[model samples]
Target: MIETIFRTVDVPAEHRFEAMRENMTNVHAPAHLSSAHAIDFSAEMRLVRLGRLCVWPATVQPARMWRTPRLIRQSDPEQYHLTLMLRGTKRCMLTGRQFGPHEMHMTDTSQPYEVEVVDDHGEIKMIGVEFPKALLPLPADQVNRVVNRRLPGQQGIGVLLTSFLTGLTRHTGCYRPSDGPRLETVLTDLFSAVLAHHLDAETALSPETPQRTLMLRIRSHIRQRLHDQELTPATVAAAHHISTSYLHRLFRNHAHDSDHEGTTVAAWIRHQRLEAARRDLADPAQHAIPVHHIGLRWGFSHHAAFTRAFRSVYGMPPRDYRHATCRPAGPAH
Candidate 1:
């Protein structure tokens, strides 16, 4: 869910300074503004929580020179902030680096920094993502060098980074709990790609940590190659530049104690194939495809073996399972 904190500054000459100061302190506005005349301004901010990550969109108008304190506190459990300016211009300085419009900035609440607004007349829109320092895969020192530095948003890694943030914000509601780990992986990749473009050392993200990432990659690869007859463990491992034995080790590492690791992998593959075959069998739109062919299309080389495996997994043979699932029941038993 998303929570919003919105306030508008429309005080006349008498209260402009007080109103501006209150807003600056409350929202932690990154600029210092001094004005003599009365001002009318409004700003809307929304922060959406996604697991350990937070996405926020902010829009403000009625430009004023404002300075944000270096030791800004965060309500989030995360400590790092990444901001992308969507519209208007902003001059941000942190760790002795300056950033402008369409640029990305990283700020650590543990440190202090200053930002100045250059063109506040126009609508200023920004998207900020907050994450924990531990969640970041890059080394702290390497990541620190880029903090407050202006990264070009027009090309290369910046474009990809922006696109991912925009897409995530737009579709955050549709994401499910099952997708959390995968989403984290995607975010990690995007961050890595960004750091790589900047030529920063990523020793902090050493690949020896959790098995979740390798498993996710392996699953994605397997799904994509499910239809190919040559998509064995050796082929899959070679494609990923890992040895077949290591790939087996990864699968074994994740399997339950009672199941043979190879059998577990094979069972998962068979189950997916069976599910795809069942969908094809039941789809009136795909009525022309033969049931056996549908099974073959999903990596089942032998019809008898496919049928037996399907029955074992689904409690019925392939044809019977298809009939029971696809056809409407006359009445409940």
Candidate 2:
């Protein structure tokens, strides 16, 4: 237990990119940095070491891009980061997943990844838990299954995990030194449950747990493959090793299909696609990426179809929306 140790680091606005690079590599993982607007950046991180797990809350300004291969020259530690997006958004290019407020994202440091801050608002805040590779009960392959995917903070183990991580920072001053090991155990158990639930490896979990885990895994699968033109009910069902009819039953039991009268699986996928596209189109960093390209990036096949769908939901064309949201491009700071 490392309850006796608490540290905080900050990068002032005038410090520029090198300061950020130094801070991140020393405090978190080593990564390459980009963004001429880095001169506009500032950051702060508060860390609490809890045995094998470290809980930290970070707040950063101005959008930034990070790539691990940029500065890493030696062996990469097998560390996994479970991040809760407290405010703003993050898009992991490696998986094409975008995490919004109240969502949790798992990232493995061993793999080279590209992540960019997605909030147009000045800064982003998040609670991140960094733990050793073995601390996660599941095998490496199992962790890979959930990495880069958005885990909802609203329900199931996600809710508990999110609350616990955030509460650690909030009540750090109250915990006694003896609580470190206990806190470490709680962190491992909760996060392990979150991972097991998502991977459907809940064989040792309660019977009822598997059903909820299955539903969540189904939703994750749908979101992950949203860009695939061939993504369909049958494919999702097949991928899960369940019959197409049983898949409908699962969704029906979870209130996602016909007779249950909620958003159908297809509708949910469409909503996610549009939401992803909207984010990209609104991103200041994507100003030069073209409206149609943004649509295509999120799985829209036809320009006309993308435009119709974009206008249908937001009442504004993609072009107009980008024009309205993005600032004029200028010399990089």
**What stretches of model 2 exceed 4 Å from their correct place?**
1-16, 69-73, 204-333
> Candidate 2: lDDT over CA atoms?
0.74
Give per-residue CA lDDT, model 1, range 1-333, as digits (tens): 444454444455456555656655444434345532335445556655555666677776534442334333432233667778777666653334545667887666555655544444656778877667787777677777776767777676577677667766765665655555556555566665566568545344556433534555576677777888777777888887888888778777655321111334666565557667877777766665677887889898888988887787668887776666575434558
lDDT: which candidate is best?
A: 2
Expressed as tens digits, the lDDT of each residue in 49-155 for candidate 2 is 88777887878764555546644446566788888998898888877888898899887787777887756776789887887887655688877888888899988
lDDT of each: 0.62, 0.74
Shift in Å, residue 317, candidate 1: 26
